[model samples]
Target: MKRWLPLSIIAATLAVAGCSKAPNGDTNTSTSSQVAKTTANEAYLALADDYFNHDLALNPISATYVGINDYNDQFGDQLTDKWLKQRHQLNKGFLAKAKKIDRSQLSQQLQLSYDMFVYNRNLDLVEETFPARMIPFNQFYSPLFSMAQLGSGGSFQPFETVEDYQNWLARLEGFISFLNRAEDRMREGIRSKVVLPRTLVERMIPQINAQLVQDPTESLFYAPIGQLPESFSDADKQRLTDAYQSFISEKLTPALLDLSVFLKDEYLPASRGSDGMWGLPNGKLWYQYLANRNTTTEMDVDDIHELGLSEVARILAEMDQVRQTVGFKGDMAAFFDYLSSDPQFFFDTPQQLIDGYMGLKDDINQVLPDYFDVMPKADYEVRAVEAFREKSAAGASYQSPAVDGSRPGIFYINTYNLRAQPKWGMTTLSLHEAAPGHHFQISIKQELTDIPQFQKFGGYTAFEEGWALYAEYLGVEMGLFEDPYQYFGKLSDEMLRAMRLVVDTGLHAKGWTREQAIQYMMDNSAMAETDITAEVERYMAIPGQALSYKVGQLKILELRAKAEQALGDKFDIKEFHSQVLLTGSLPMAVLEDKINYWIASKS
Candidate 1:
């Protein structure tokens, strides 16, 4: 979603109600009542475009990620107390203005957009009550990691021109400023008695030090200098090199060093010992809002926790059948051990492992047409995760290609510990992270030239992650996983999501300790210890994000089953998938309503 902004994560993870002065060139809506005058659905859409464009300019990192280059040299304001206040005012004003439009007059498509915009605004207002900004930079997600990706010359930030190099020099200034402000914000968190878990702080300190390079030439920021275009004149190249050296040493390095010292010497000493959100003020209610936002459901914690427990048990019974099929003579725990340590199940080299995923591409392509007609035009490539981020990053994630096709969509396979990436998980991992999962769903959204920008680029976490998880199960329909070991891999991946339901809720809502959550995961699945540890810490660092994957997947599966039942022979898999992908990511309720309408029409 960087095509949108890394800062957009702030907007995504916490839907804070915000208000700001509209950027220059926004449609001049002189009064709050003006929305009523733009009643033609297209006019209303034009206004939505204006509002979204204003956001793109505000979040320049997002602009770079999404391929909008106007703010390529800028960085969002660090999460200052002032920034937070303005963001609140901005959201409140927009929500109020949008409310002036007559929803009854709009076409069905515009109506859906209108309802989602309003729902998101209201959700943001609710999120304004939390202290998320306090713990801004986690091991999993932080400005540090995002900036490293950009400066390392391998990510969204372009370095094809001298100005591109200069643009980044300017952007680094903003990032350096943010690091200082980060310490200030965390200090405030300390004073307010809101602090991150000790486990997360332990992880974050190393992340900060890893970026604090003393020598200019040795910096990851120096990476682009090495790759400067051959077209650059000798004089220009020398000048740019000197400038980058100065910027990294004089400006960036000191800031990183200061951040390193502050986090270790000051912040870490004051961090929370508790592992769950239950340790914070109004923690229960805080976790509740997160749960609702992630799942887009009002289900009680007990219900989600119970659902997780039930799913885990059901998946285990299936795992036993796989064990028997593979001719293992032991119970589930022994099978888990055999799968984890067995040489046959582990790849000897990273290239061999990557080759395995690449090989799946041909097999996947053949079966793809039978299950669905819609596919993204964009080509996707599989690559190992960049060394800088491989450790903390999820096993695999799909970054959408630049809509303009300057870049190919990348499937980043984390090869940190080859064993953690079990051979059994490869097929399902490739499906979920590469084909017909994130790449298919996300690329389809960006390719939607006809939809409103907010609809095109915006997302509901449950809907998006849920769609990817649902895609993993789609493997079976495609006749993948004929090998019981591979089918068990699919089940193992499915079990991980089910376990997320239990541990995410258990840790955040049910007072489960970090160790308790880890133990529960170990008992339930054959996931590697490193993977399990990182995941538990991730849930701790970000409370309810893990809940979204399973919650969204189950809903899609249920809805698909409903469509098949109602339409009988008329149900077409291709059309059903096309509807899901073409509509873009949506809230669970909105998606369900849309699907139900299709079901009725088919009947």
Candidate 2:
């Protein structure tokens, strides 16, 4: 899983200062036409820049993640009515201006930007109609979790200078404001009946309690103080340390405790008993909107449900083939049990797990060039997921490098439960979260000079996740999954995605309970009970997101198959990959159009 910030504007403004006027005060046809296109493109680019820059101001934490530090000390008040109105007006105004730009007169690239800008702004406008702001924070996606990661000092929040330290202190104050607002919003959710499941709210209690420490130095927020630069004067260091300790104990800790108490004493009792999105007001339409938004397609709920069922059946057969090859004599259920319990398949320690993923880096890097012509300049490294959030974190996930290359992409392997991180799953997991998967796709996009900041930094769930899932399948063709057990890992991971399609739709659309979704997963794959529960709750917390992996992978595969069949011997794997990646992330429809154009030109 790649950490995706919620803002979805992917546009760039190319400021072509001016178009040259015709000589002798007379217009030349070709020159005039060129000038018109340039003027139109620049005009649209300026509009895009306006939208992009304002969005960053509204999401300062996300701005920090993308390597922009202009608002590092601020956190936007996103759930307030004033904030919502400002956001709506921002989109509405930019969208109207964007539409006024004659897309036909812009160059092809700017036209793509124009279409995406309009689509995203329109989607934002539609999304605001739902009561999402009322239910702002959940166990899974929240500003709270982002702050925890940043405060740890190991993440993106810069602590390089005295100003950096002060920025974080100021940012902490803003974060506390967010917590207060979140409590207000969650209360609103309770009143409107747009609340989270009881199960998810239960998870939040422990998460919040973990932050309430009596000793400020023992807090995760105290990490930056310990890492103060050697260049700092003795007085400055002591002053900053005293300030941080006081802030943590006096301000931040109390805020966390208040939020935690609010959850236990009030919010939990009010949380919904029903697990799926259908339990909320107008939830059915909301889930459908999310389904379309996340997958970037107009796929109906029942169609997605059926597609999941079909994919599940198809992947199950492949798993059986792997089972037979491994000489397992028992039935699939027994095979799942044996695979789940076997000690040989599990990593002995967390360090070993980290080493196992790191070990694959060299082998994967060697084969990558055979399949991809373009590669990221910023490399990646494997690390254990921080203990604070590891319990709720995915089994493995990727964080893209900082835009300035100050940080390498991080492939976080959760070592909380070793059974969930099996030995056989290493290859497929590495391929998905690390090299030639997220790291490749995302880093390449950030490095792209031609696209706008939004396209470079923001992405659709389907396109980004879909590409990673497709990368896993690509590993098999690359001969990385040669061992039967490793091949089983591939099938296992694929089954997890295939099951997401069935389970996400089942939970949200069909009103499956949390237990039922867990059982569905347990019956289908050899995943640990811990992993199954976490994943199901993840879906409950953020409906329609789990559906992206398979929905996206299938589309990419379908496109590749079309390309392979059309071009035959003329097809080049490297070129096809470049075509998919070099444009940065795009909508499914736009991606297909681009591919079709490429195929036609090749033909």
Candidate 3:
């Protein structure tokens, strides 16, 4: 759910030196070395701008959703083979263009830019073999659900102008084509034995069903019409209303029904019963590639699994201390059962679930400065996840602030199941999702002016997500997890992340069955049955992504420990944090190199 507008803003204004000839034909000569440096810098900057602008134009809806309102309502022909070819060619052209520039002539920021361009180009080399577009929709992330967000009146689609309303109508037409293409690709997947799990298909049924309401008034997609601009005359309104009805009845509804039937009747039956990617051709190699891309490391599955096991064992021992402090007359397993089944910790109502998180904002704000410095100037808010996508979305997720400062960073707490939002988990969740976690990391990164646009706005999952997971540990230092049960919640959360390293590799690399992975989680953590099922399914949908959190957290912690030891008395937590944040998110190896430079400089 990382938005692109902030990155666009950063990249948009990055000025590079290039001089055009005067209309008067006055040629002011400069030193050859100076001219060469300027040309090189300008060439690099132009390439960066080209990449950014091309990306923004191609994914205009993404641009709009991320608060880049210039291209307010648009979506590309994401389904066409020609579009894919163009996208690949675009990347290829940029890569070739970037390589011709001299890196040594540019500033440090530009050097990072050159390196990232090359790294991404290398990543593109592996993309063709993966066939990611083949298996697009799952229970977790899907373009269908994303379209609903934009079409829904409360989100990015501007309703104040008649043109805006018409813009969406055009966008929906484009989306219909994309969805059809998606279905075609998925059919290919069916033949290839690369389909999603049956469980995921079943989950998607409800999402499609929600769009099938016979009454246009009650449909979620009707919101735009309901809240259409007041500037529209009655004639215009009536015309729009008629057009929308026909579009829905004739186009949208049919598409939804077709997709739903396809999922239930065609795709589900062919889906591999097993959860792991290991069942596919070269699955182990595929997973290794994903791990490298996700964590930016060469650590193999066995290494990650072993690391997870060690971390899980260490966290469980800490949880045992919490049980002892509570004076519970039970074994660790029994205590875990007690925690899971107890209604005392559960919220009875959805508002209470939301209020519980809302309350934490004030409580944590008072203690935020205690841990480190560099807070985001943009305000933050908490809201429940929208009902349509909440069922499949992560328990809690963060959305960054708008680049123009019009929208605040949003911490969306899922209230789909009240039982899932336990009171004890709120503190750690808030810290991770709001303060010092995603909001702190992302917003501050966006605010940085010293770095290149790509570095400032770009992200590595391991660095960004790892830092968020690491933020949970910082709760202990902030004096937020003072209560033993709350402290145990932190350990339980850590254990879940550790479990991901094991289960993600288990599913993709080790050929572990879905049931087997779920059982492993049940045996290891205090997670509820509902939570465990959701987590496993998420890993199945997006392999190796979950691994980044734990891998990144450990790296950050290692570097922090190294900094504190190396600098000794001169070690400043604020300065250390500032250094980490100043670079935005980088690959772990790159992050290590950057931090090492900081450490050496202090000496």
Candidate 4:
């Protein structure tokens, strides 16, 4: 799921809107003094706090991710029509009250919050138009994998205290209950003619079945019992272990098996054969909305489609040049074959791969301070993506640290097929997933104390993913992409993002089949076919998401180019980095404003 997959994690943070209504309700009347501005800003922040606190109760998953433990035991049912109604009402309420605040009276920072809140709510209102909840459980982000990730020891679910153990017992009951409701909604989806792709349903079946074990002790839910805090008395340990065993064997297994049966016998036949959301009712508009929401820009599918074609051509040329410079015989395809089959380019074992990334970790930390003034206090570790979900996982992903720093941020490298994890790609991948990439951006966002709580945890994919892609390019400045193959790896990675613009839009908007998308990817890059298939299916499972990487990366590059051109020799690379990052993750438009403001002030 990496099990912290990109689409789900980004979606988790997306709901956290930046702005809110001010305290004591809102006043639209203009006031012309710094004192009035200060008063309003204070009021706005208070509302932001209230809005954040309110959401924690409404969405406990959001709370757990944000490190707010108040609702740790309550796994709220977010699948029901009732839940969406509550969320809709909440958004409308905030939208109404927030609009009454006079923007001219708010500080620039508060104005950013106000604008983002307003933008996000409008988008949420747009989302209400789509029937996404009808088919909520996908292989990429269903309740099944989400629960597996939580119970699987290394993630958000704390195992520190006896209460932590007990909290999960209660939590899984709600999670299991949701399983039936999820199936119920899928049935409703069938009635509404809203069904997931047949390919995606096939994937979901195994993920659900993965948790169905006859022995309770072997269950992931029972894992915490094995790691029970040492401080627990002998009696307490025995009792907790008994509780978990009974819960898993009796309550949990039946629920998992029930959902799996529904998916296999009832749901799979109803699933459609089409790849894109465009095939659904109102699907064309849904894809359009998803593109805007994910990219946080006004780009349509055609604009993104053409941009992908241009970038793919440019990257292919770069790859060709690398093939020649490396003195490899034959064409780019032959070189892709050579690079892929060469035993010298892969690890014999998983430990070697882990050791390789760990080595990069030390070297990167030594060089990072030279490029940027800001750094994350939270440390990160490299681990293989856990085995249960590794089959469908991305090559690498980063999970932000627990806000309290008990668990370090993780850079999960998928070591399932060491052959697929190419040696040359490691450096660029490391930078993107770890230091100066996701770890740097996400951990820094988590560490920022000056932003509103929603903005602190909130993110837009374009800003978050764009900064990471930009980080991948930073390897050139750090002197890491010196080897021609390593540089090719960078181009390959960039090409993948660029190809996303092509294949992703091509799949959903242009009617490219799965075979067609896979063929296009293979023709263009040296990526493993296994990796290519996983990636192609990922785009199928979650549409318009892959578009975010290229769209985001290009924007960041554009802004940086502008900053350098405007600031001229006055440009400080470190300052430019800090200015973009210091505001945390903003919508692309808001990010532009922040960077342009920096450029103007410096000029």
Candidate 5:
């Protein structure tokens, strides 16, 4: 979960190899070629800059969340037709100009810029086909929930000045407008037969109902009013408080009521009964497109399914070895059940869960240098997932540092369910989400000097998440998986990712029910039923995203083996890792190409 901001342009001047002739007696031919090359570089860089700034302006909240404060905390008016047209036109114009740039003439970094821009444009095209706004209020990862976060105390919203409070007031009004537009777009989805799953709609009912409680003072959004800047005059404070109360009662409550009524009355009944994407029009084609887009490869659903099965078999055999070493008196299924039900492995309290991860930071730091040559200068911290969103969040996740260094990278452990946060799982989780995992890969990429901002900060999920998953494997080499139970935990975690490959495709491609997907997971792995249910629902909420981790990890491992075989004694693990991290995040295709080039250069 690295925070990716929109791409910015490079301002470097290029040096050309030759000169040109002048109109005068003095020959200037030698300088003319250099001037032309410099001009071309400048044009490309300028185009990138324009595209980046324009994108941030249109999606201000996304920019803010990623720590791009150019818009200074303003939110977008997503409801207005004028805003929608402006956003579409911005993408179109950038794509048109980007197409004109001769990619072959640019450096490798510039070429990546061209490719990412094209990929983003392609996404824009497909995005129009799906009516995502129709089912916006999921239990996890909703824009509405994010809005409450930004406006609440103890978060990013600044309340130091009167102007700061006023800024939020303006933003709140825009949020109301955005919700209205979301309702309109969902209505369109209802008509188009692209509604959300009924199960997801049912889950959302409690969330919407919770917001409708009659006391504005007790509402989460009221925190801003309660904590208004101390510098404000008493008169101003009273006026602001009264205004917010009125706004919440009159405008915000009605908006929430309208949205809830629509979801319950108009949208839920029309929601799709089937869980898979294959139920939609052109579903097979749609899923194929998603598979390629997410995996960053042309491999079809069948290929991915087979790959997952093979990996699952291999990891299961490894898990069995751990069972025997511990002298467990049962088969693999019994071992899994023992692992799931064992009380000694579970955390009793959430703080104990948080402390376990906090202690690992130093332990990992001491051991990381043995396996990785490149390390991030950016620091990291461990924290519990925010209470509001933790129930639906992944078991553990990472948020990358701000490009400007204002914020540290965060490893958020979900402490919502202490039973789910096993002590044995902590080491592998730490390795994947923190040191030498996401925090290492993402922060170092952002710190690179020679690449364009987009390549530095932009992320392909397969590359980012896959690299993190692969990082867990590296822990064994670093001697972190010493305990047999911890080793079992590593394999268990890998199995979960491998299962994602099977179950995600099963849900979105093979038309698996939510229960069917959950059952597949329970039958295969040691995860709790509660965890399996959460994961399956997450896939339903955001299709094609879960498939990236295992897919990307396999590709990286494949490349490493190839490099090791080719270079023989010349293969330096540190150097191989340096090459990968130095290039920043790339599509799997581009990553493979870069690795191939590195291999050739070594030869």
Candidate 6:
């Protein structure tokens, strides 16, 4: 999975509370004539810069992640009405201005940029229509989980300096307010019948309880103090340590306990019994919007549900070929069971699991030259998922590198259950989550020059996840999946995505229970029951996100095939990839336009 900074971060806070400078306006041009004479490129680029800087101010956490330290000390309250109103107005105002820009006067590249900017702003505006704020967080997308990670000293939150440590203490104050407001929102959700499913709430209680420690040092929030810089004098270190310990015990612990107790005693009981979004108010329409938003297309739930079924069948047939090649006896189900049960496929230790993925970096990097010309300058490392949230997290996920290159991209492999981390799945998992996949695509986007910061950082889930899935398939052409088991692993990983298409829509639109979704995955693929359950619950938590993988992968595959046939001997595989990647993550329709234009110019 490619981890996305939640869009909710941008939808919060007071008006520009940070160290960001105002946009350098055209101070010399005092008249309307000068403004009117501004070129489309100049106007559009200015708007892009305005949007990026303004967004960074509101979304301080995201600012840190993107390598901007100006807002590191701030945490805007996302759950408040004031924040929601500002976020809506921000998108609305930008969309209006973006629409007025004359596309005809812009160069080809700016035209693409203009279209993407409008699409994103329009989508952001549409997202505000749904009452998502009423149901603030879940086990998978909780801010609490995110904050804990930031506090752990391993994530984007820097602990290298005294200012950095002080920044966190200030951020912690805002986090307490966020938790209080989240409780208020959940209470509102209960009244509105927009609460999370009971299972999701049940999972969340434990995660929240994990934070309610008797000793402040035992808390994840205390991690930064342990790694305080050696340069600090003993007196300064003591002061900082005392400050952190007090914050964790007096403020953070009580806030966590309140939320945890509320969930177990009040909220969990009120959570809905049904599994899908169909149970929420205006849920059908809301899910339809998400499907369209996540996939960056007009695909409705029915279109996606049917597409998933067809893809699942097609991939199963391919899996059968691998089953036969491996000389596995009996039916496909038997083969799935064999693969799931076999002890040889399991990793012995968590370090070995991390090492397995780490080991693939060299061979995978060696093959990159043949298929891709544009590669990320920033390197990546594989690490085990943190103990707090790994049980509920995806099998693996990729975090993009910091833009300043201070931090490398992280490929987090979940080793909570050894059985879930099968040896055969390592190659395909690595290909999808790390190299030539998210790490390559996202880093290259961030590194691109002459583009707006929004273009570098903001991306369509369909395009990003789709490209990663496509990269997994590219492993075959790169000769990385030559082993029959590894090939099965490829198919198995693909099957998980294919099933997600069916399951995400099924759970959200088609009234499927959680159990039904889990059973469907187990029937189709050799994934462990535990893994399948985690995936199914994940779909329930965030409807329509899972659909991005297949929807995006298929679109890219279609465009590639079209180019291959159109150019014939002229088609360069490397160039096809470069064209797709160099432009950053685009809407699928825009991507089609781009590829079609490339083919036309070549012809």
Q: List, residue by residue over 328-386, the lDDT tens digit for candidate 4.
A: 88988899998888999999999999999999999989999899898999999998998
Clashes of 3: 0
Residue-level lDDT tens digits of model 6 in 468-586: 99999999999998899999999999999999999999999999999999999988999989999989998999888999999999999999999999999999999999999997999
Model 2 lDDT tens row, 9-48: 2221122222334556444654566667766866876777
Error of 3 at 444 (Å): 2.0
Per-residue lDDT tens digits for candidate 5, residues 1-603, read: 222221332223222232334567344554654455455555676776676667778877767655665554477866466876787787777888888877765655566666777877777766656545455557667776788877875455566777767777777787888778888878887888877789888877767777775888877778888887778899989988987788888888888898889889988898899887877766667777777777888888878888888888999889988999999999988988888888999988888888888888889899877677888889998989877677677888887776667668889998888878788888899989998889999999888865555566578889988999999999999898999999988998999999988888898888789989998898888888888899999888777788899999989999999999999999999998997888788888778888888899898
Which prediction has the highest TM-score against the true structure? 2
Q: 233, model 5: CA deviation in Å?
A: 4.5
Candidate 2 at 498: error in angstroms?
0.9
Per-residue lDDT over 6-119 for candidate 3, one digit per residue giving the tens place of the 0 to 100 score: 343334333221344334644343234445655566677667766767877777886775556666656787757887887788888888888888888765545665777788
TM-score of each: 0.93, 0.95, 0.92, 0.94, 0.91, 0.93
| Tens-place lDDT digits, model 1, residues 1-603 | 213212332342233213322345233433222333223454557667776776776677888888777887888784877777777876788888788778775655567778888888899889988887777778888787788788877678999999999899889888877777777778989998789988898898787788777788988888999999999999999999999899888888888888888888998899988899898888889999999998998988779989999999999999999999989998999999999999999999999988999899878988888877888888899999988788888888888888687787999888999989989898998899888899889988998765678887889889988988888899987888899989999999999999998998899888899999999999989999999999999999888888899999999999999999899899998999988887688899988888887887777
Give the TM-score comparing model 4 with the true structure, all chains together.
0.94
Please identify which of the two predictions, 3 or 6, would achieve the higher lDDT against the true structure: 6
On the 0 to 100 scale, the lDDT of residue 250 in model 2 is 94
Measured over all alpha carbons after superposition, the RMSD of each candidate to the real structure, in angstroms, is: 8.0, 4.6, 5.3, 6.8, 4.1, 7.8
After superposing candidate 3, which stretches have Cα over 4 Å from the reference? 1-39
Give the better candidate number (1 or 5) by TM-score.
1
At residue 528, what lDDT does model 2 achieve? 95
How big is the RMSD of model 5?
4.1
